[model samples]
Target chain A: MKTNFRTAVLTVLIGAGTVCSAVAQDATTILQKMDEVMYSQKDMTGKNKIILIDKAGKQEIREATIQQKGTDKRMFRFTAPASQAGIAFLSLPGDVMYMYLPAFGRERRIASSAKNQNFAGTDFSYEDMESVPFSQKYTPKLIKTETDAFVLELTPKVRSDFSKVTVSIHKEHFYPILMEYYDRGGNKVKEAKYTFKKIGNYWNPAEIEMTDLKKGHTTKMQMTDVKYDTGLSDDAFTVRALVQ
Target chain B: MKAKITVLLFSIFVAISGKISAQEENNIKLSGELLTDQRLLLRDNNDWAWNENRLTLKLDKQISSESKFYSEIWLRNIGLPNAVHSSSLYNKGIIDPYNLEIREAYLQINGFLNKKIDLTLGRQQIVWGTADKLNPTDNLNPYDLEDILDFGRKRGSDAINLQYYFNYDFSVQGVFIPFFQPANMPVGIFADLLNPSIAMPQGMVLNNFSDTLMMPKYNLGESSTVGLRFKGFAKGVDFSLSYVWGYDGLPYSSKNMLTPVNMNGETNIQSELSFMRNHIIGVDLATSIGGAGVWAEAAAFIPDQDMVMTTDLSALYPGSPEPVTQDSVLLKKNKPYIKFVIGGDYFFADGSYLNLQYLHGFVHERGSEGLNDYFFLRYEKTFFNEKLKITPIGGGFIVTDWGDINENYAIAYLPEISYKATPNAEITLSAAIFDGKGDHLFASLKDYNMLMLKMKYSF
Candidate 1:
């Protein structure tokens, strides 16, 4: 009777393990679907307006023109703020990046280690501004499931500023609605919320708000004149284009 | 002819602006900044080193989908506290201290003949190299030394630039400058201190001294400058190879004469200074290794001819000398010399930045033997969400001679603190201290230690 009871317990444990594996697989699939929905277009161009708010409620605004091709190439050119005008940032595949300052009249290579640093004094880090899809950088596991969404806990595959990130993805569309970022010490340090709108058969992010809890600062980016599948050539992402 | 060219460029700019204005899809941009910089020396009798207010205006207009016109202008009121001469005030109705400068005015046309070709004409700055401030390969434009503190600043040159792309990762650029422009030197007390003086013999005293500057003529082979560069990127590395045929911005003494005034030991000296022509071949590369950004730039300068300074001492000792004697010194040999800079920068996890560089030569230093080694470092940290930045350690160490560095070294320390009072306004406090024991560049600046305050606003 004791042997039979042990076997039954072993079977139940194995069954639970199988269920966990299935859930993890489901989570990865959902994450990939989210990435697919985010970057469904072949190319995209938009004008972005960023508003930064300090703890004391002071606000500063910046404007930029953003262009993206595929899921790897992206470029940002600042158009507003006289001091920052004509500054450009280009991100290409294999973690290559460059920054151009009009005053210098040349492009400077940005190291991969600078990914964690804030971009242009904004709350968004260089990693956050990257055009790479999340599925390529993080491994996800389903932590919980709600009536309207599935909560996923993601661990980075490579070195990163955040230890882990928790994302709440919509159940129907597989688009992320909110994300909470934790530091290496396992403390929640930042949060990001997204608003998506369907623009001619594509789910486009209309606005995104990122808040740094430790610094008591927030950055809100609003997208306008969004265009998708514009057939942008590869030449547009080159260093020559960046300086121009 | 230069005036005609300038007029033609402006006429083209005006015609393009008119054509673009008639189109409803034209886009025009206007931006600039206002700045006031004040510096004071820290000495027994404290004095103002620099007091100036400047206004900059930039205009950009899109003429077509593949063409654009851009211009920048600066208006400066320098030496605000200096008194105007009564004679000048009497001659002119109002003695305005403000001066206007056209910094850049260029017309850029993309896809000139094909999709891979581009052309830019008029006054512009053609910057090259991969290093930060100490780029040995960036010599197309003459240095702008109006403010010595503003290092790496360059004046715009009137040129025709053409770029052709072989592919997305590689391109070639050619630039032709019709005229040569000399470097602008600093004014005021610094100028007097930096002026070169003649070294006289022990027995002879200098009664009078005179000098003449000999500039190159306005001819294609004499005054014109040309440059070519081939740039490419591969495996996450950007590289460039460039060649420039031009004259050095600084002049060298070419001829000297010493004449005896009387039987006494008093003498008069006359000198002639001229610029040296050279050919520079440069190579530079920039890449990231193990998370840190690294760059290196090197230039090999080959002078066209040997620089010989002839001092005619025949008149100094007329009767006592057995034969007429003329002293000739070889200032610089017609050999190839190199200048290079290697640098790296990293950002720490705690929001600190560190940049370091090893430079083999300064701008004014030419010959291989005359070049001094320098190590530069800058470290800074930001506080209060990046509103305040403090650079506690920033400056360079000059080693005049590597063998005897203990006694032939100079150290300069620059500490700065800047605060962003508002989104568009900033205030900065900085100081430069120098100490040295030998004949390095910084040794001459030991007594010129200064404190500076700057206020800038952008609109």
Candidate 2:
């Protein structure tokens, strides 16, 4: 009819370009299946009750609890009111300890001098409370693959502390949707946006924004009654449950 | 003092008339400033044009919700004319016109319990250290380098303060100066050395307080003060600690004869003393890393309760005759006197931020018998984008550790330039290089070099 419809449209565009080049050449198994579907429905490893809100919208509700036991152990725990209950913020993979209160009852160990302060005076800072160990500090770069997302450009392979991280994953679910922070005069103060919603089989992020380019401030965290793998422990995230 | 100013204006007018019948809200603040200086120091010496003007008026009112009622009034050196006359007897008078009184008035209170306690009782200005020219243990207030070379004026105190906090780190403060008003009083060392016709006599009643300005030529006793402060911060480290106690020294002697018919004029001895007893103690520390930052401090003053004795009121006024004695042990040469500072700051890799410092002062023995042994060096930097700023301040007063004013040496070299223009306007250019030798040539005028230009507008 028209040369058999131009050879069946070039054989369905070469079979959708070999299935998108086999999922972009296995980029670390598509980023570990996007961190197991972004921690498949909670229980992503014990404890968390953070509330950091600042930019003059002042508010710091904390009851920390985190213990992530895979992808390199991490721990943090800070109880409440009675003056920073016990306080503990550790990271094991090249040191980072911040023990707590010791005007007497012992527990002192905060030195590396201010890891970049600002975690209660909020606006993140404390190196933005860990969680970015992207294979020894970034260097990621995938660039593109639209339709569901997957665009990375991390940089910063050694300054020993973030100077670049531009993630944006999704691609059928590996959730990350945004992260920008740069300052060493590289400008770009801060940014963190996420807004996934899928419920079962996970994609988390039901709302999270944290902008602050030189203080114009912004902070929004909405998760309203979430429940994922509810089974936290490890002495409820230690330091004696943040000083009991 | 008028019953401590009517018990501090009746506790701030009954806490602003009981917070206006309990609607609880009150605040009335007003700030003031008016300064001028024009000194073209002899380039061609046309009678050395000198200019100075000052005007300050401040008022603050905020009753209930933790009191506050303040005042600061001044109108000095306006277009000169206080019957001009100054060239030593000690030099300070000339602010005539009935003494235009009242320099500061105070009252303050804060969060009784909830907000973590605080209370201030009138006439205040207490600044503690971070060294900018050796603040020898920063004793409440005391600084008047001829009003910073004719009107860059800055000095404060009139105290009663109490503070306490249990959060935001930690704090504890206390300052009291029941009576210690010393600032341009008795006309700064009695017009620099008496002789207002020998302390008034020909139609006395000099200014208000008439009756010859309430005679009583010289007597500065009955003084009191107390202080305590503590501060804290965790994780990012920060610290401060202080202690002070008041009333030190008491002495007055004035006698003169400056040749009332060839009996010699160089013998007008005057002495008004207060030999230390205003306890003091201090400590400070700061820390930071990851861009670097550090600070340090130290203070001591206990001996005769901390010494700072200065003499030679024309040689000890009131009928002088050999009276500047001591074979040591004038209370063992009163001790204390120790001030120190160490600094650090760095953050340059194209972001600008470099602050280096070093300061020291240690001349116990009454600053080795009247002032000396103080050194300071400061450097500040920031360029372009930060809107240009450069500061190079250096200070001195080694004078071979005093002692007969040991070949006296007083040096100052300030070079500041600022240009903010916007962000509330700013234009500054400071130049100074005052070097006075030998007991600072009886207090300055030996190699003077001063130039200043400042314009600041902020809203």
- What are the models' TM-scores? 0.94, 0.30
| Segments of candidate 1 deviating more than 4 angstroms | A1-3, B1-25, B80-85, B88-96, B262-264, B318-334
Q: Chain A only: list TM-scores of all candidates.
A: 0.96, 0.30
- Angstrom error of the Cα, residue B373, model 2: value is 12
Model 2, stretches more than 4 Å misplaced? A1-81, A85-124, A127-142, A145-150, A156-160, A169-244, B1-8, B16-127, B131-159, B162-176, B179-221, B226-290, B294-326, B329-338, B345-459
Query: In candidate 1, which residue pairs get closer than 3 Å at backbone N, Cα or C atoms, i.e. clash?
Result: none
> Which of the numbered candidates is closest to the native, going by highest TM-score?
1
Interface RMSD of each: 1.4, 17.6
Superposed by TM-score, candidate 2 places the C-alpha of residue B325 at a distance from the truth, in angstroms, of 11
